[model samples]
Target: MVTTQERVGAEPDFALNPSGQFGVYVHVPFCASRCGYCDFNTYTPGELGGATPAGWLEALRSELALASQRLPGPTVDTVFVGGGTPSMLGGDGLAEVLDAVRSEFTLAPDAEVTTEANPESTSPGFFTRLRTAGYTRVSLGMQSVAPTVLRLLDRVHSPGRALDAAREAQDAGFEHVNLDLIYGSPGESDDDLHRSVDAAIGAGVDHLSAYALVVEDGTALARRVRRGEVAAPDEDVLARRYELLDTWLADAGFTWYEVSNWSKPGGECRHNLGYWNGGQWWGAGPGAHGFVGATRWWNVKHPNTYAALAEKRELPIADFEVLAPRDRHVEDVLLQIRLRSGLPTSLLDADEQARAESAVAAGLLVHDGHNLVLTDRGRLLADGVVRDLLAD
Candidate 1:
């Protein structure tokens, strides 16, 4: 449990939290256009129709202030602004949010601030403004560099524009840039995937997050697939693609830091790392989720409702639950197993450890000192392996 003293700093003057850590995630739910495969909570401004008229910024600030009041502690170590397309916020709006964050929390001097951007929404001047506004890292969504694949995914920007955005991000003096790509799209060939990878490497970013497409039930992609409009890639094909991606990225001097993330030396995303490591963070904005100690909560999904509730000086929490110790333990095991660090022996019982040992002996895991990590083949069946190891 977080003590009251820990929640609020003791001294009248600025005092850092003794815990020395906390992360902040700001969600920007505005998107110019939603992708076919995306089911994230988002809305186009055109749909707003002046109901709130850019009031989200103020509402978000108010919400942040509320969060500060509830969990007033030291400066945050990392801040990540992710979204439908955070670049849609233009430079000025982005600056306003960042300013609010600075006032609400003690931000570390070298805190890593990352913002997600879509190639179509990004400009060189905009990137420069973001840098001046204190964003140290930029993640660009360049899902695919092939025209056919882009069309299949309904990406707003052309392949050329995506590459240009990457170059512009570098030119804007961002020390760390991440390019996001998606594999296993319908009708995507191995050649197409390779070209996308080659293009990303050519664009010269510090990190890459390549994800396989999953068809969520209510998504447009899933509906289309059901209607025979697009064909989903088979498991065998996806496995081959994953293998190629792992091999190629390793050859390109990138480390597989997580299942879907690869980064150059010293370039891992600290905010995401905090999640995997079970660190505490505050999540603000519509549909944003936060984990503080054992309690997990999420904000309301509707923008107008969220703003309205915040205006009344109340948290827009739609639902929340305090996890039991056993639940927390299970989650810790599950999250850790997905990372390269693997799980500590102390996290599992003797019976579970015996099962893990058998898997290790079968070459699915490698024992590294006190931790057990997945081998390449194990990564392919990570879900099943984790379930087996965590089973009671």
Candidate 2:
């Protein structure tokens, strides 16, 4: 496990091409409430005590100002505001966040700016302002459309809210809309997932991200499963659900671009593509992570500490490591293989290339003369395939 240490002072590497495609990821750690299945670094107003939204925004601005000076570059090609509930900051607050980013970096001619918003937290005014503020995309956390599934996941939105939010965003002039779905919740049925998919398609979203629910340790859901309050979905059942989701999404005119992401042609989330394709980015806010070249680092997890660092005009970087060549290669395989363009064979060595060939023979991949693309089955067993490809 990569562990964090105290921030070791160093200048951000400005050796990057000034005109390169750079991304900015700003984290908003505030949420209305904690969901049972969530373990992300997020806090509610009650839990946050005196750490008001205004203070957090102030600290974020300080970090952005500092980062802009440290890493001089052309306008950011993409920016993603995620976590807690970004919409809870309200449209004006979100606009302010973007404005701070603008003060430091210029936005590219077609910069893909995205924000992840919860369904219940948005309105017409909110969407209208977001578009006016220059946001190009909105990814709403729809989770599931079934009330039972929503309750099981501890999601607060009503069954129709996500669809309603999607329509509202479109009405507000956002053609680039994405709905995030979570399948395999303990009580989620095939029919429930069907409704969810149908509703997402009906919403006319251009992008969809359907993920399998994994009960991570320490989450409230994990505890429920541990105490037998809820049964975990059987592996075979989850597999079938995944197949159903893929079929439904494909029939709805969406193409699988990643393991859990689908999109219409030209509707892919460019900000995410930046991350998967190894582009440089600076992560702002508490518990955010950033990367430049082979060096990756994370900020302090606590909002108070993060605020203190920023107020002191510090980078707020907690720890960083220059990835070893092997580490970088393993990560490339891990991320690139899951992408639709597939992993380039040129990234592998003679031994790994042989392994790739062996994987092809095993029906886990198809070498299309240039790139090694995952077959349908390979995507389902991607973890094992990654391990095999990385094997010594």
The candidate scoring highest on lDDT is 2
lDDT of 1 by residue, 52-73 (tens): 4278888998988877877756
Q: What are the clash counts of all predictions, listed in order?
A: 1, 1
Clashing pairs in 1: 75-106
**For model 2, what is the C-alpha lDDT against the true structure?**
0.89
Q: CA lDDT of each candidate?
A: 0.84, 0.89
The runs of at least 3 residues in candidate 2 whose Cα sits more than 4 Å from the true structure, single-residue gaps closed, are 1-20
Q: Pick out the ten consecutive residues of candidate 2 with the lowest summed lDDT.
A: 1-10
TM-score of each: 0.94, 0.97
| Global local distance difference test of model 1 | 0.84
The 10-residue segment of model 1 with minimum total lDDT is 7-16
Q: After superposition, how far is residue 313 of candidate 2 from its true place, in Å?
A: 0.8
